[model samples]
Target: MLPVDTTQLLKGVLDLAVLAVLRDEDGYGYDILRRLRTSGLTEVGDASVYGTLRRLFNAGLLSTYVVPSVEGPHRKYYALNAAGRGELQRSGKIWQDFASTMDDLLRERETA
Candidate 1:
């Protein structure tokens, strides 16, 4: 059996993962990337996360604001808007259903 390419898998679900991370708190690009890595998605890359954030913002699913930082440059934090929250809910349900189906199939194979 071939090993799964998790980076490819992460590409498919990066939007969902980013939205999930922003569900609780708004964060800047690097902070969001860090949260994802800390949550065990260490394979997620900085560029991927930044691109995802930009896409989400452009799609009207996210809002951004700049916060001044004394230590460095201003940070643009991304937050989930109403549409983003709705999308998170809708996509989250779809993901749950798909995951359940996959789990069931794998379990059946194990039993067989």
Candidate 2:
């Protein structure tokens, strides 16, 4: 299969992705980045994740706190607030619907 431009696709879904990660547990910037990679989003970058965290926090969808770290400076952890959780649920549903439709179309094309 041809490679897809995941970066372009990720632009619109970054919020949902970040919120989804925070939905389960809080994480610092690097920790969140690692989680994205672990979740199969290998093309995701550190800068993009950091920016999304800032935007989500500014939009009041996420909350943040600092925890002291022995390895280095204090870590800023992010968690999904009620608003973030709501957005995650709504966006996940929309994505699921869109993906299902795309899958149906692809199947029809293959059969034709």
Candidate 3:
């Protein structure tokens, strides 16, 4: 099989990852990007993540509010609304199932 470009893979899952972050707590644009990087998703870009935040908010999956920050300007923070939380729960289950199936598909064949 050809090697998968991780950037391509990230595109499909970026929404879910963002939802995952917001599932735990609200965060601003840069904070979300930093969290993704800390979790070893180094390929994720700042603009892409910020764009996704706006898109998700537009789609009504996420809700936003402004809060004062110590370092920078009063930042827009994002959190999962009811719909967003629902999406996260559903996506989390889907990913868990997909991972299990892919693990089976990639395993070595047994020598009987």
The per-prediction tally of clashing pairs is 0, 0, 0
Best prediction by lDDT: 1
TM-score of 3: 0.90
Off by over 4 Å in 1: none
What would the per-residue lDDT of candidate 1 be over residues 1-112, giving only the tens digit for each residue?
A: 9999999999999999999999999999999999999999999999889999999999999999999999999999999999999999999999999999999999999999
lDDT of 3 by residue, 1-112 (tens): 9998999999989999999988888998989999998998999998899999999999999988999879978988898999999988999999999989887777744422
Ranking by TM-score: 1, 2, 3
The sequence of per-residue lDDT tens digits that candidate 2 reaches over residues 1-112 is 9788889999878888889888889999999999988999899988999999999999999999999989989999999999988989999999999999999999999999
Better of 2 and 3 by lDDT: 2
Model 3 regions lying over 4 Å from their true place = 69-71, 108-112
What local lDDT does model 2 show for residue 46?
Answer: 87
- In order, candidate lDDTs are 0.97, 0.92, 0.91
Ranking 2 against 3 by TM-score, winner: 2
Pitting candidate 1 against candidate 3, the one with the higher lDDT is 1
**True-vs-predicted CA distance for residue 83, candidate 1, Å:** 0.3
